[model samples]
Every structure is written in C-alpha cells, then in structure tokens.
Target: MNKNLIRRTAIVAAAGAASLVLAACGSSDDTSAGQSTPSAVSSAPAAQGQHNAADVAFAKGMIPHHRQAVEMADLAPTRAESAEAKKLADEIKKAQDPEIQTLSGWLTSWGEQVPAEGAMDHSAHGMAGMMTAEEMDKLKDSSGKAFDTAFMEMMIRHHEGAVAMAKTEKADGAFPDAQTMADAIIISQTAEITRMNSLLGKN
Candidate 1:
C-alpha cells in the first residue's frame, strides 16, 4: 500500500518474469545441443546379410581377377588356330562378360570401387593358377596351333584361379549375392576346365 513500495514490487516482478523466460530459452538450447543424429546403419543388411570388411575386400580383389580372364578370353579369337579353341574362347567371352558386368554392378550398388584396369598386380598377389608374365608373353607371341595349345592351357589355369577365388568368396563373404555368384563360377568354370583339358589333348 505505500506508493513507492507498490512500484518497487512491480519492478521486481518484471525482472523475475524476464529471468524465467531466459532460463526456458537456455534449457531448450541445452536439449537441442545434447540430441544426436542417428548412426547410418544399412537397411539392406537383412536381405543381403551383413557385409563386413572381408566381403568388401573379396569384391575388390575378384573384380580385377575376372577382368583379366575376360582379357584372356578376348585374345582367344585372334590367337587360336583350331576351330575348337576359338569356339571355347568365344564361349568363355560370352559367359564371363555378363558375369563381369554383374559383379561390377554389385560393387557399385554396395558403394565400393570397381577395380581399375591394371590396378591390381597379379604377380604381386601371386594368386594360384595365375599365368606368369612370361607365360602371357609367350602366348601373345605364338601363332596358329602353338597359340591354340598355349591359350587353352593358360585359360584352364585362369579358370582354375577364378574358381579358387569364388570358393573363397563363398566361404568367407557375407552377402547372398556374392555366394550365388561364387556358385555360378564354380559350376561354369569346372565345366570349362574339363572342356579345356580335352581341347588341349586334341590340339
């Protein structure tokens, strides 16, 4: 009831209200700052299974290996003397080209890099059944029947390497798609290996 006291009380009430408003704003900012964005877990993991580091490495390694096989298969048409050798080479190209495309596509879908041409050194990896540089050179230099024989032999070894790599993928890789591809390589390459052996004898 004193006039000065009434004014003072009104001033104090305004200051307290302003302090409460500031406290509310500070609390809201603290809540916002404390919140975190969700981690990026892959949604397709259940459908394809969990792809780990091994699956990635397997894809990275195998893509180049398959590409080299395609390169060798391409050479067969030019180098083979025998009709059978040429036919086998043509068949190899047909089967492997689609597979190469499929594997490359899978790598892309998985957000992995497709191995560049000549990026991986076959000699350094020392994959079993890989032709040595000297061996490839010999095949390239040969002509006619010599080329046919060498090509069949070299291709058989190459297919064997593919089969080996596929088996590794099947055993170690997590994705169902990778295992399916591995099964295909096993079936196709086994048949090709047998056919190549017969062709070698005939040549």
Candidate 2:
C-alpha cells in the first residue's frame, strides 16, 4: 500500500511539471509576437514624419521661389517669340504647381507655416536668383524675341539659385522626402540650365 501511494505522488508531480513547461512556452511566444507587431507599426511613421529646421527652411523658401518661377512661366505663353521658350515655360508651370501643393501639405502636417500668397517679395529675404520688382516690370513691358531672350537669361540665373538651395537642403536636411526632392531639383534644373544656355547660343 505504501508503494502504491508513492507511485501516485510521483505521477502527479510529473504532470504538474509538464504543465508548467507548456505554459512557459506559450507565454514566450505571446511576448515575442506582441513585441514584433508594435515595432513594425511604429518604425514606418517615424521615418515618414522625420524633419528638421533645414527641411522647414527648404520648404518655405522654395515655395516662393517656385511661385515666382511659375509666374514667369505664365508670362511666356503670351509674350515669348520662340517656340522652345513657350514649351519650356509650359513644362515649368506643370512641374512646379504640383510641387507647391506637396510642399504646402508637408508644412501643414509638420505644424509649420506655408508661405503666404503675397510673399512674392523675395527681395526682403535676399533670396538668391530672385527678381526685383523693377526686373519683373521690365519683363512685363517686353514682348516677342526680346521677351524670349530676357526670359531665358533670367531663368538661367533663377535656376542656378534653386540648384544652390537644393544642394544646401540635401546636405543639411533630415527629412528623406525633402532630400529626394532636392536631388530631383538639382538634376532637373541643371539639365534645364544647359538647355537654356544652348538655346541662347551660350553653350
């Protein structure tokens, strides 16, 4: 009878130990799964939302710069004599308008200020390659071949300024999207500058 009692006690202990081991395995699996999920969800938004002061400045300054470029492009359809100049102006307006919207969206999402509509007076900021009021007026006063020549010359200078700003942003900005935009600007504007120079026989 004592032997039977000992055998029964050993079986019960073995069952309890096995149960504990199974429970520990289940708990470990649950913890690992929970940890992986939250990390995956968190990493993406953090990367997307990252920005710094340089990114903000790039967005702000480029807004007016792009707006002024668009304004100049708008004049070309009516005033320019060269077909190439008109086509180039059209392309500039199309590319930059969407970028303006995108930049504004990023600023709004970041709780930053979008540049005001009347902020065309880039002279106050002493922004590079920006036209003076007199220069704009002069362009407005001209037409035909004169308009084409003036537009190409001023745009070349404006594009050079934009390239400079983009280089700064690429080097100093933390936002990935802004950096990508800066790269695009550098490549596209440099090509456009070359094209304009060729059209003007300056190449």
Candidate 3:
C-alpha cells in the first residue's frame, strides 16, 4: 500500500511539471505575438510622419524642377529631329508626372504649400542649371537637329542640377519616403545624363 501511494504521488508531480512547461511555452508565444503587431503598426506612422526642414525643402524645390523638365519634354515631340529624342522626352514625362502628384501629396500632408505651376519662372535664380527666359524662348523657336542638340544639352544640365538636389536630400532629409524619392532621382537622372552625353557624342 505504501509503495502504491508513492508511485501515484510521483505521477501527479510529473503531470504538474509538464503542465507548467506547456503553460510557459504558451505564454512566451503570446508575448511575442503581441509585441510584433504593435511594433509594426507604430513603425509605419513613424516613417510617414518623420519629416524635417530638409525634407520639406527637397519636396518643394523638386516640384518646380520636375515641372520645368516636363515642360521641356513637352516641346520635344513637335520640335525634335531624332526619334531617340522624342522617345527620351516621352519617358521623362511618364516618370515625372506621377512623381509630381506624389510630391504634392506629401506637401499637403505636411501642411506645406505646394508650389504654383509657374513658380519655376520666379524661382529660377535660386535653382541650379535652370534655363533663363531667353534660353527657353530659344528652345521654343528651334526645330530639327538644332532642337535635338539644344534639348540634350539643356536636359543634361537640368538633370545634373536635379541629381545634386537629390544627393542633398539623401544626406539630410528625415522623411523616409522623401529620402527614397531622392534616391530614385539620383539614379534615374544620372543615368539619363549619361545617355544624353552618349547621344551627343560627348561620351
């Protein structure tokens, strides 16, 4: 009878220890699951909201810069001599138009003023590699090979300016999306600049 009692007590103790082990594992799993979700949810808003002055400036400056580029691109279909120039111009418009809207959205969300359509004309002096009124007039009047040559040259300069601005954004901007956009600008414009140089036989 005594031996039987000892065996039964051992079984009960073993069962209790196994249940405690299972409960510990369950508790750890629940804790980890709970921690993961809130961290993910909180991070998204943090990324979206974390903008500094540099990010605001980058967005504002780039909007007008992109607008002027699109304007120049608009001229190419009618004025350019080469098929390549027209295609390149089309690509520029396609890429930048969407980006313009995105930048505007960012500005709106941040409570900053979206630049006016004609702001480039007033702000040209502050921006690098922007064409003056006379230069734009000259481009507008040109046709055939002259237009192609002028377009490529002017675009190369314009792209260089944009790349510089994007580099600054990458270095200083706090907003994650803005920094990403800056990276895209630097990569795309730099590639376009190289392509333009190759087309102009300067490569």
Name the runs in model 2 displaced over 4 angstroms. Answer: 1-43, 121-124
TM-score: the better of candidates 1 and 3: 3
TM-score of each candidate? 0.70, 0.78, 0.79
Cα-based lDDT at residue 93, candidate 3: 96
Highest TM-score, which number?
3
RMSD of 3: 12.0
- Candidate 1 ranges with C-alpha deviation above 4 Å: 1-45, 122-124
lDDT, candidate 2, 1-203, per-residue tens: 99999999999998899668657766677777644654666588888889999999999989999999999999999999989999999989998899899999999999998988957544435898888778888999999999999999999999998999999999999898999999999999999999999999999
| TM-score of candidate 1 versus the correct structure, residues matched by position | 0.70
TM-score winner between 2 and 3, please give it: 3
Q: Mark the regions of model 3 whose C-alpha exceeds 4 Å error after superposition.
A: 1-42, 121-123
In order, the Cα lDDT scores of the candidates are: 0.76, 0.90, 0.89
Summarize candidate 1's per-residue lDDT along 26-133 as a digit string, tens digits: 666666532321112225557565676666766776666777777776777777788898888788778877877877877788788787776666443686666666
Kindly indicate the candidate among 1 and 2 with the higher lDDT: 2
User: Residues 100-138, candidate 3, lDDT per residue (tens digit)?
Assistant: 999999999999999988866455566977877788899
Please estimate how well model 2 matches the true structure, expressed as its whole-model Cα lDDT: 0.90
